[model samples]
Target: MYVTTPDEMRRIDNRAIEEFGIPGAVLMENAAIRTVNVIEEKYPALFDGGRVIILAGCGNNGGDGLAIGRHLMLKGAKVQAFLFFAEEKFTGNARLNLDIYKRLGGHIELVTHEEDIKTLKGSIYQADLIVDSIFGTGITRDIDSLIYKAVDMVNKSPVPVVAVDIPSGINGKDGRIMGIAIKAQHTVSFGYPKRGHILYPGREYTGRLHVVPISLPQDSSQAVGVKTFTLDDKEMAQNLMERPRQGHKGTFGKVGVIAGSLGMAGAACLTSMAALKGGSGLVTLGCPASLVPIFQSKMTEVMCYPLEDGQKGYLTLDAITGIRDFLKDKDVLAIGPGLGSKCDGLEIIRYILREFDISIIMDADALNHISRDKRLLSDYKGSIVITPHPGEMARLTGKSIQEIVASPIETATEFARDMGIIVLLKGAVSIVAHPEGNIYLNSSGNAGMGTGGSGDVLTGLIASMVAQGYSPYDAAVYGCYIHGRAGDYAREKWGETGMIAGNLLDELPLVFKDLFSLKG
Candidate 1:
């Protein structure tokens, strides 16, 4: 589903009003009606003489609350609205709704003084439900003290709240909390979901989001160029690769993985095993000469190449020729998992990037090497996808981990566009960004996938997709979804705390099976 920033949403609203000739009041009315429908459906008894308190500001969001109050009053509920601003402060559609509600004999109170706050607190304590429309997506400053106290009282109250558009005090574009925000039991988002509804603390405050249509033009979002999307199961299912009935092993794809060191054999094993599970026909692991015996014994199906490690248990400058030879017949190469951050390791990566033209996936230490000189990626001749956790991304971009986490989509997309490569920024919500500015936000996976070596499995999965004829961008997007889906399956079986990277590998087949069935 496409996720819009506040500015994008405004443009869509403007198009509906200006080009489509839909009146702003009509849109507000539609939003209020849909929100009331949701409230009635979710809280069925609210209209049966229930008491509802509305905390409304002087903006369009407050107008929505007034309209909702009018609807609830018509439904035989006792509705009272507390206006934060003076009654005369409301303008436009908000003023229209306020007048309509007042003409319908709805009770209205002003919440400007301390005595009014006490009354608001008492009403909140007694109401069955509270409608919060004090602020909307357009809020650019911190909430005032009086409003903050009122919000605090509402939060402290035991009554459930239904928010309009978005929860009050949330920075709709970036999900930042402006001073304070209301924690709602349900949020009614009109047209499309805002970024605040999906990202961080705003997501936490925005409970049980309902993206209801407010009768805007169907193509309004497209007219405004909204490109960011959250990946869903249906889309992923439709995009699943079909298995040919007469296809042979050679027809599938070949994956070449160069990973592992003396003590990090698990990384290599997991990557190669995940590739096999991800449906690579021929899987090869090119490792340090000293680690080949360990890999050969642990991974029976995977072919192993003992690169010239000089018995140091890690790749060196001498291994470049062997790597080049190993990747000559491969459709895709996955580099960097468990690879040490030695100078020789960096040299090996530099050589591979300079020489190879195949699809390459860089993770772990390879990303570390590139961070020392990001221009290395800009100069590479082949398609490259880099999977970096927050720390690795910080090194690669020279930004703080906090900054990357704060704006993951921007960070990933900016880097991808600048470096001319696909970037998969790993986190609770992984972001797959293409150089062309398209972004896919992953909605699968649990905290269980935070274990070590999980990213290696993802690297293999993505490489497998690329080998199987997916474009680099598509491969990265699909690979992230499938990887997280496998982790979700693992979480179901082992719980979040107990699941490991190997557990994710074991679940990959099941995820693919489900996807294939979905395709059929």
Candidate 2:
């Protein structure tokens, strides 16, 4: 399923109308009907005959509320439509909905001034439920002081509030609160979920999410492209169930990971160990010749390839050509985390992405190098995946980490689709965006994963998944899920504070069992 922003949603709507011949009004009506189901199920008693107040703005979101108001009133509920923007503020289908609603004898009220707000206070408090449709996704800038005060009143009010689409006052693109936001007990979302519904702060504000399909054609959203996606265990089971049996080591695939340097050899060790644990049939850890012995001493399972070493046991471009042999018959490749890109790491990475045909996972310094020159994206010849935490993604996209954090879902999705690569933007509710505009949101992992080397493990795990049979999207999604689950399991034994990336390597078998054990 795709998680999209307000603007991107509009594009989808436009494509539906222009290309698929689905009219705008038809979509709005469908949205209202679909949302009605959630409303009915959650508050059956309230919708029967109790007083209901809908605080609606002058947009499609408000239109959805107004349409619902008509339905509830016809069903014999005492419904009051609080039109926040008055008559002149109405536009498009919104205006049409209000006109029809009023004509149908649906109760309507205006909230124009502070006095009007005070006048409605008693009704607001007495109402069983208030539908917050005011200032939906269209609200990108800071709201007026009046609306801010209203937000306080709504949150403070004893009446439970339900939000339409995204929570009112949320910047859907970045999940930032626009001045203030509605505190919803439930948010009825049309089509799939949105970034604000999944990303933090805004996610908390969204409350319980109720997703409804609003009669858009099958895959109709594909026209304008969707950049956000979410993954659950159902996804893992689906991917796992699809894997063929009787697959030999060659059929499963191999991954060559070029990692580890002076002090970061632990990164290589953990990543190599994790690659094998993550289902890679075979893994070769290509490190500076000096590190090979250290890696070998640590693990007999992984093959350690020694590259030409230089001063103080580091890798240079001189040693990059040697990586070619390891590439033979390799299914996927991962670079960075511990690879000393200081000498020729960036150049080596550039050469490999430009020259190698295998699927790739770029992380840590590799991401940093690409941040310096995004031109590397256009020059690449094969399927690609980049796992960048907020900071790294910010560096790669020239956005501040603060900005990205506010809307990791949107920024990551846009960047991935725009650059034509699969992007795993790591953080809470990690987002996976593919070049085709499909996106996946991960639902696993815990706070225990907030440690070093977790990312390196993820890089290796994703590369392993890609090598084994997963698409770039599937690889990133499953890799993050398993990585998080490993952390979760580790947390159970070691507690969040004691859990570390190395702990995940030993717990990988447990994670695999949990995944494969799930019944259809």
Candidate 3:
């Protein structure tokens, strides 16, 4: 799955025409055919002498709808090609499609005036299906007048609506609504899924997303700097090899998790369990010696190593010697869950970055410390991954939280490129930015994942992946997707208010199992 910008999609389309020598009409025809096929397959009743009302505009999306209407009419399905744009405005292949539909005795009407929109209300509501092809990726401004009323009617109408490419009134680049958007029951997007269909209110409006491959060549898309990415599950499933049988604990990987304090022993326990669930064969918890009994009692499976106790049972610089000793046998490290920002805890993090030679994943207060000391940004001997909420990212980059949240894509890419680390800026739209300038946006998870210990769980998951021989970038992106997906699963069963970190932890096994099995 890739999140493509409207500009990128248009660029891809043009590249297909120019570089690949594929005609634009051919792509449009293929898209229209696929759209009609999906509609007929999804709703067999639509072909039973029921009429389809097409709300077409003067753009290419409208062209797709008009072509679909013509196809349906040719197939003996009652169809009405109700359009909003004046007939003179249809251009190129779109105008050609309008001519074909008219010759086939299709009903074509305009609703340029507000009164026209009001008059067609009953005809639209009476139709069995409404095709929302008014505006697609080309929509870039506020919607008003008849178009607004049309979007409103689609929302209130009893007829089902299928959107083309993207729902009308949604910005294809940003997920923001132009003014009003159609609530479509199905969206048959061609070539690839747009960014709007994956984010917020736009995603809510796009009911079921079905991707239809047009005549565009994938190689042409890459030539035009189409670097936008979508995290597809089946691709990730094929990434890592399954666990080797007849292998011992050390054969899998050893993950060292430096977490927990006096009052936050639960955080440490959560991270340890998540690491195990994330497929780390061996996990070691490094914490103040005071909480040894608590880890031993709460997490009997993990090997808890005692470190020097600093203020309030936090690890200080005195734990550096023991940390180095622990790291000698560890494959990956995750720090900053319950570790309070004592001087020792801060120094411990700095020491690990400067001296350690394994993969490191940071979260919570660790990112906070890195944000304060700008000098520590370049002090990494091994691959580094940082999972941060907007506030943490803001602190790390010396930017306001609003600034970080406003354009997360730019923020994460900027920080990761500058610091030479992979940054997973977490939220509804989790971004994975690598030093190589690749950014992956995650579309998993629900509102239930906003609870506590979620970040720790993500940290553990990433560390587990790194320990299991995954690159830092892959580990971070895959971990964010799985962690969020597990949260989504928990939410489906427990509901938002009922969901807890423990529920996500409980669903991790099921999520992993289902994702891997789906590869078949």
Candidate 4:
């Protein structure tokens, strides 16, 4: 699903009004009508002799609230509107709606003073539902004025609140709460879901999201630079093709996973198992010689190769030639899960960066070693994917963890664009930034996925897809979605507290089966 910024949404709204010859008043009316429809359909008994209070501002959002009040009144419900601004302050479509509501003999009260706030509070205390249209996506600053007080009042009230466009005081572009934001039960977004609705903090405030189409042309949104998108199950299915009946093991592709040391053998096992479960036909785990025995005993289906190791049992630079020979027929190489942070291991990573020609997906220790010299990414020749959590990303980019977390999309996008590679910033909203400048935010996964070995599983999944002939970008997108979906399934079965990285592997078959069945 395409996500729009406030500015981009405005451009699309404008194009619909100016270029498409649709009137702004009509769009406002449609938005209000759809919002009311949602309330009625979702809660049929809400308007059965129940009083509703509409808290409106002087902007278009307020105009939508006024229209909703009028429609509710027409449906034999008691509706009262509290305009935060002076009655005369409303203009355009908003003013027209207010006039229409007044002409219908609807009750409208102007709230401008402290006494008015008290009366508004009394009215809200008696109302069954509240419609919050105080602020929309155009909100740019923190709410410190009277509106802040009103939002606090609404949040404190027990009545269910339905927000118009976006919850009041949320920065729609980035999902940050502007000092204070309304805790809304439902948000009626016009045309498409805003970035705030899917992003954190703002998502927490928005209880349930309902996107109501106000007739904005999709092509207009695309034309106006709406590049960010969230994936759904259907699109994910379309991205993956059905398996061929005549396909052999080599037809799927061979994955060379260089991971694990002496004590971190579990990391190697998880990654190799994840690759197999991720639909790779052949998986070869190249680990230190001492660790090979453990992997051989633990993993039944995964093939193994013993590479040269240092005294500490970590893969050394000498292992690079052996790994290169091992990867001769491999379609993709997944490096760096549990590969210790030793200098020799770093040397092996550097060797792969300089000489490896196959597509590479680096995670964990590989990312740690590369962060020591990020210049390798800028000069690398082959397709590369780097999956880094916040701390690792900070080290790689030489930025503070605070800076990267504050603006993850910008950080990932800029890195991907400049480095000409794919950067997967893994966290709450896993962001995949492509070299071509398109950004995708993953919509699946839950807090349960924060367990150890999750990143290894993700790296294996993404690398498996790449080996199966997917572009680095598509592989990252699909792999992230499936990995998250598997996590979701695991969470559903075992709850968040019991979910582990291995649980993701257990659910992979069910996820792939359900998704691949869509091809029929």
* Per-residue lDDT over 153-208 for candidate 4, one digit per residue giving the tens place of the 0 to 100 score: 98998999999989998889989999899999999999988999888888888889
**Model 1, span 1-520: residue lDDT tens:** 7889989999999999999899999999999999999999988898789999999999999999999999989988899999999988999999999999999899999999988998898889889999999999999999878999998888888999999999999999878899989999999999988888877778889999899999988888788999988766778999987978898778789999999998888998999998899998989999998888899889889999889888888887888888878989999999889888752767787787888788899999888887877888988999999999999999988899999999998999999999999999998778999999898877788888989899999999999898888998999999999999998899888899988899999999999998888887
Who is ahead in lDDT, 1 or 2?
A: 1
Tens-digit lDDT track of model 3 for 1-520: 5568888888888888887788888998999999999998988887878888888998888889999998887776788877888999999988988888888788888898877876679787678888889999778899998888888887987888899999999888867789999989999999888878887668888999999888677575567675568776777677755888887788779999999887788788888889999988999999888889889988878999999885448776788888888889999999888887763656777788787678888888777776767566566768888888998887787789977766788898888888888889987888898887787878788888899998888898888888888888888888888998898889889899978898878999998998879766
lDDT of each: 0.90, 0.82, 0.84, 0.89
What are the per-residue Cα lDDT tens digits for candidate 2 across 1-520? Answer: 6777778777777777888888788888888887777878888997568999988889888888999888888877799988778788899999899898999998887888888788678788889988888877767688776667777888899898889998888888767788889989999888777777877768889989888887776675566666556666656766673456877777767989888888889888777778888887899988888777788998899998888777556787778778878787788889887875564777787878767778889888888877777878756878889999998898898999988876675787788778888889999878887776566777678888899999999998898888888888788888888888888889899999878888988788887877777735
Error of 4 at 431 (Å): 0.6
How many angstroms is residue 80 displaced in model 3 relative to the true structure, after the best TM-score fit? 2.0
Which prediction has the highest lDDT against the true structure? 1
**Of candidates 3 and 2, the better by TM-score:** 3
By TM-score, the candidates rank as 4, 3, 1, 2
Work out the TM-score per prediction.
0.95, 0.81, 0.96, 0.97
RMSD of 3: 1.8
Better of 2 and 4 by TM-score: 4
